[model samples]
Target: MKPSFFSQYWCMVSQGWKADLADKERLITPLLFAITVLLLFNFCFEEVSKGIEGQVFTAELYLTTLFALQMSYVRIFVPDQQDKVFSLLQSYPLNYSAWFLSKYTLALLYSLLVFVPVMLLCGLFFSGADLNIWSAELWLGGLLSIIGLSTLGILLSTLTLKASGREMLFPLLYFPLAVPVLLASVQASLSFLTSVPGGWHWMGILAGFDIIYFTLGVLLFGELVTAV
Candidate 1:
């Protein structure tokens, strides 16, 4: 009998996690890239107004993390696609929803691994531990953005698997669909930084979109990899 969905999901995530760890080069490069971008943003914004600077910081962080997420998942399907392993896997008596969630979980874990550490370094040292910068708002906003980015990453990965010139086509396909997530992440940070009233609305939008994205991926993943 096939393992339960949770069991299979965890098994897949753990294997992917171990593989990523073994490939330290892949992890180091993107992490270094995130740290470098954070440092540059910190220096650039040092002399700006604190209140509005918060808005700019939020926007910059959101955009940078979005790009990093895209890069991290760029080769998400390389193993299965290149080797055609997915076809064989599909023949197993497994719940494919676990497959979608496993990939999403792995990507989200990597995205947060890159994004959070850099943001923390910037927040504590570069920003002098500003109160507004270290609040639940920033972390919560980041969590939402990560969730959205995870599912979106997987969806985009499958979509571009067989397409020509994927390098050019990925961001073209990814960014437009992710505009809402980017906006919500920025606005949520801005609202928290400025103590504005409307950040909850953006948070709600993020939560809704995360649910929608995950649902679609889970429901359609079987077809998505079949060249949809």
Candidate 2:
């Protein structure tokens, strides 16, 4: 029997999700990096705790989480192209747009999987800070950031597929493109931390970025995939 369209798309997402979970090296690297960064911040900032304001530790933690999520997108797509698996998947019955969206969905879900626990742990360590400000707006902003980053990553992954030095190329390409999202996220996060009323505008900016990038990605990705 033929699979339904939704079933086929979800199968693509599930395959991507499982591929991520099963790759212990790829999976653990980000988590360890995040923990190490957090611990280093904790120790490094110990003496300056009194001088620090605005939950600097929490800000660092959020930055670490975002960085890890960005790395995971690299890991997921780069290896698939290296092994020619992405090309094979592209040849399948699923529409290329569905495949792209499925990967985006997987990346977003995987990022949340890593982010939530890290945020909670950071909350525990930084007592007296109202971590409860992780509000609906914050969630929306995060999702937008993820969408924007993942779209960009997908585009770059295709571009760098055959480069001999893609590992180096990935960060060089990713970080510059990611600047806007990171800035918007930081602003939104600061608004959340400060209990400011106008923070939602930052979230709106993030949402707008997501919409613009996702649309651009969908349009540009066909050319990207076919170019190689």
TM-score of each: 0.89, 0.86
Instruction: Output the lDDT of residue 155, model 1.
Output: 87
Could you say which candidate leads in lDDT? 1
> Which 10-residue window of candidate 1 scores lowest in summed lDDT?
122-131
Give the range of the ten consecutive residues with the poorest summed lDDT in model 2. 46-55
Whole-model alpha-carbon lDDT for candidate 1 = 0.78
RMSD in Å for candidate 1, one decimal? 2.1
For all candidates in order, the CA lDDT equals 0.78, 0.72
What is the TM-score (0 to 1) of candidate 2?
A: 0.86
C-alpha RMSD of each candidate structure in angstroms: 2.1, 2.6
Predicted structure with the largest TM-score when compared to the true one:
1
- Model 2 over residues 1-228: C-alpha lDDT tens digits? 666768877888887767766776887777777777777877777643433444584477568876787677776674475567877866767666776777778766767767766666566566665444556766666666777777777777667766778889988888888778777877887677667777788878887877888898778777777777
